[model samples]
Target: MDEHDRTRTPVAGRVEADDRPAPLPRRITVGIIVNPKHSATLRAYADLVPQLQKAGAHYRSMTTSVERSGRWQAEQLIDWGADTVIILGGDGTIRAAAPVLAEAGTLTSLVPTGTANVLSRHIGLRSCRHAIDHCVRTVASIIRDVPTNLRGIPVNAAEFRRADGSRHRTEFISLAGIGGDARAIAHHHFATGLLGYTWGAARALFVVNFTASTGATVGAGDTSGTEGSASGQVWSVMASKVARPAGPIAVFPQARIDAEAFTVVTVGPIPDRLIARCRAWAGIATACLQGRPQAHPLMDYRCTTDMWVSVESPVPAQLDGDLIGDCLELRVSAGEKKLLVSAPTT
Candidate 1:
């Protein structure tokens, strides 16, 4: 077959000859990984499974538990030959399953069942929370030949090492950070959905310790370390693949999920005086909300492929809204894997 003949539709009601290339499947198989904590996810599953079955598509369902991670569930789906995997939770759920799915080159989509469905909003899904029945119908349509387009978005993976020499790796579909923003995520637990994120950010303003300045160094490559460190007293650093990690709050308005790079935002130390600190953060917040964040003396935003960050001591960290505890070193690289998502319908 020539390069142009990669995709071909088979003749209806007939099988192809052995010498000819096989056509696309008559029906697609979908796998759903649900966060059991969300009752809405359970509701959507009940409504979705029947619709998929009626459309002649095969499907399998798995629930996330305290003992089992999304990675394990996703691996099961891939082994079962799923044509598409539907994640029915928030950014954290997506983060857990995405690396495995991306590595396997499987098509994926989301239903936004958790607080701040940032990926859905970034991909133009708009609504942070969707009705269960509506989400069910949308998933059904996409799997049943609704002519929706596919998008390949970059995923950020990190290798983290603690001051005590323990190590682990993680991936994020939206945003990750070390410092004040992460403190907000750590303190974020009120109401539900976007309001909780807002309340958390508000609560952080009064309690978060901005004095722990990470004398951080940034290197171009992932392997470079702290011997030749840049002398900046950054209070926090955020790296994002999407425009807004918190819904409607644009930390990096210029960010594009489909792009092969990451937008890294760094915040400098707050003022010593109370009034001065208030004014400084107020200015930064205003600029970010307006969708044009100015390069202030205390803050900076830049695009890069990979970055290596080393701090003076253990400090707060987070990935995709989930806290990463304290870390002394972090290496974040973009475009390591790209997950295919169904583009939102216009």
Candidate 2:
């Protein structure tokens, strides 16, 4: 294998040049949290750091060994006075750091290295696949484009209340999962990367417990309006702030993170026949790829301040993109208080 291929997550196509002007080097301290599972290296970020250093930027770097530990590493960097924190992995890596940075009002940036770098896409960073010279240049351009005063858009987060009365809050900047989406997340192998998610989703279709038979009572109410309800068996429910899922697919095409409201989409149950299952899967996939919401009987869409789901039977759910285990009920809402985000600078 060539040196370029050795340092990157194996991907299609060749790298390209970064066209942005070089950013002025500044004397700043930067804290970096890298996910080793993605096979990122100090050299992988070579294009980004040197420019910062040219301006006299000091740096500290650490690799996260477990899920969510990147946040702890970022906290360490902040304690040591890092003026900015750079995340060098996928959305999960960034998610781990975002809450911490938001709470502290710290600035953050990304060098996406995951299968589907949703956060990177949201911030308008160009996608690069390899560690070749072209890839380096593209990343450098993104660093140059980093905005000075990052304005974080507000997002809806979910609060889950189990039948036992225990409750906890999980912030989902992009999408919140219920039913099959959550089950797929819970069942997916952590080591399998992107393919794991696909396989888990495919398998969920055949598994009886994951079928739409898992009933739910769904409700919606605007922040300034009256309460309403929608209930029945569901294959999955996604409360989305962003239109896309897993990258290009627009499962919630009308969802917007920057807006005060979000959308709750419930997938009607799958049919018992094999032919119907395959057709349902294909139809939903096609509609999503087209970036159009389906108007079929198998789906229902609602836009509101909050969407609540009370599961008839326990099923799994995901927050952001991480599997947060099973729950009896969940309430997703964009609360009055906004999360302070140190968004990308361009």
Candidate 3:
């Protein structure tokens, strides 16, 4: 038999052959979590509603605000019987909804409408249009199929507790960090998109005290895998499950979403001179962007399942693009649960 004939499945002795598979018997219900601040997202949603309607799909959408969180909206959707969730924002939005959906085993998707859409881009949802188109197709399927835009995107969960005895645990689907980068997020919270991030980074460069160093400890487990300690003049420390957090820079080149352990990159203890520090920062960034790993006294990289970092003074911290305020100590470990997402497999 030919390729087409062999692939066809007979139903009631009748063969139905087509390039595209028929829609599943049961319809999918989609839950859209939108960031109302973006006009482009609103426009995309407007176009999406009619397409979903034409496709005979059932959907419920809500706007996220400073008061109403994505996690709350996701819970509401789940309560409303939604099995599939679509986030129309960036990493921060995804992180907020992740815990609830992962526990419920809900399939999540993203439209990448916020700043530094690192996770969204890594999963092949490059543009808003691409993400929206995938949503239309997703609502037509009932079962999870590998041939379509469905994937199990792995993410690390972190639990952090402060030295002051206040305990708070949160899940992050993207990069998490302490020091200058986190301070930058706090400074740029008033702005949006790349411009905001740039402004924040610039402001942080001048305002942050780079001469300070923090004590860091990392390990894959209680006693197994890699273990190390560092103390010196420190700049910033970050951890991630992806090769790159934003743009072309592979901050953790050896890392992967599906990997069992995440990679941590530490850059610090450089010359106290501002110009010298700037040169080092630019050089390290350039190397990362080129996907090259080099050995330098000012930089350290390691793969670990758990990391503990503490400083003499509290520094700002951020996870998945959301600031976590000032923290003197942070402990992060890999989570056991893996979230399912609608995206191309890496």
Candidate 4:
């Protein structure tokens, strides 16, 4: 409630870092949102309630499976005098609640329970991927104090409206692109788990590589009839917000989570004459694997405040690590939202 009551937490053992801490509210009315399907999330919720009570906090918990997207639930808690929100799920759950929480002016704590807790690592919370007990205990043990705000990465969120007259909004934390990355995300399945993602990436890489080797040209295009625009044969382009994604492959090391500008890594300008698609894709792949994107001429990584990309084809756009249906053009720029976060203690 006051400067003297603010607590501190060390975060070096974790992968990422946090800048400052927020004072814990005196009343401590907490709103907790969980996803019941994740057994780890359930276990963490059980442990979290006791911890909050022992700390003299009043809390209410709800599962996303029963409450849809948790958007309305978050608003309800805000109306009920809850100043802090604890989300017990993976990246998607946290991301889904982000825009709402930002507008509600509530501080949020993340207990990683899903498959790749990418943003958690940046905020001093690291949960082992798919490890239930370890993750559950980790989530419960880290609510030491009210956390501070996190500088949100900018994203060009695309609206994908379906024929059923329904609309879905998705968040892109790290990278979004066309070509192999998008194709691989489209092929991924939730039931198959991590294996599905690995296979999808592998298949995408090899398929692109083989197609290049045979001198096959994959359809690529840029926009015209708008201001001054330079055109290149675009094979693939990734707009990066963070230095690393879910894995070790640093596709956009130049990108920072809190950077004012995001990086756009493009690979292309394929030869008009017959040439190996394998060679171009391989060069892009190598840069990704080594974390040094400028290693090849075919790959170009640039930082910009805004960009416009016209694919000119109907293809699923990969936002963050998943596909977000079909779209034509992309408008990339800095977002207006700022999300407050409570980073876990060291």
**What value of lDDT does candidate 4 attain over all alpha carbons?**
0.61
Every candidate's lDDT: 0.74, 0.66, 0.74, 0.61
Candidate 2: tens digits of C-alpha lDDT, residues 4-40: 6764343457443443366664455678787867654
| Model 2 RMSD in angstroms | 13.4
Report the C-alpha lDDT of model 3 over 1-346, residue by residue, as the tens digit: 7776665445785656655488765666778999877777788788788987877768999888888768899899999999788888878778888888888889887887777888888888768898888877776654343245555655566666554657787788768888877888887866767778878888876554533433333555546454566665577888888876755666777887756676887766545688987887777766766667545556678777777677777788889878887877776777777778877543
Tens digits of per-residue lDDT for model 1, 24-52: 64667889999978776777677667866
- As for lDDT, the candidate ahead, 2 or 4, is 2
Tens digits of lDDT, candidate 4, 105-201: 5767777777667777665565633232333333343354423334453333544443344555455445566565677767767337667777776
> Could you say which candidate leads in TM-score?
3
User: Considering only N, C-alpha and C atoms within 3 Å, which residue pairs clash in candidate 2?
Assistant: 16-134, 18-137, 18-138, 25-55, 26-55, 146-345, 147-345, 147-346
Runs of candidate 3 exceeding 4 Å displacement:
1-25, 143-149, 161-165, 207-227
Tell me the lDDT of candidate 1.
0.74
Off by more than 4 A, model 2: 1-26, 41-43, 128-151, 161-166, 208-221, 335-346
Weakest ten-residue segment in model 2 by summed lDDT: 211-220
TM-score for candidate 4: 0.72
TM-score of each: 0.81, 0.75, 0.84, 0.72
Quote the lDDT for 155 in model 4.
34
For model 4, which pairs clash? 212-276, 212-277, 212-278, 213-277, 213-278
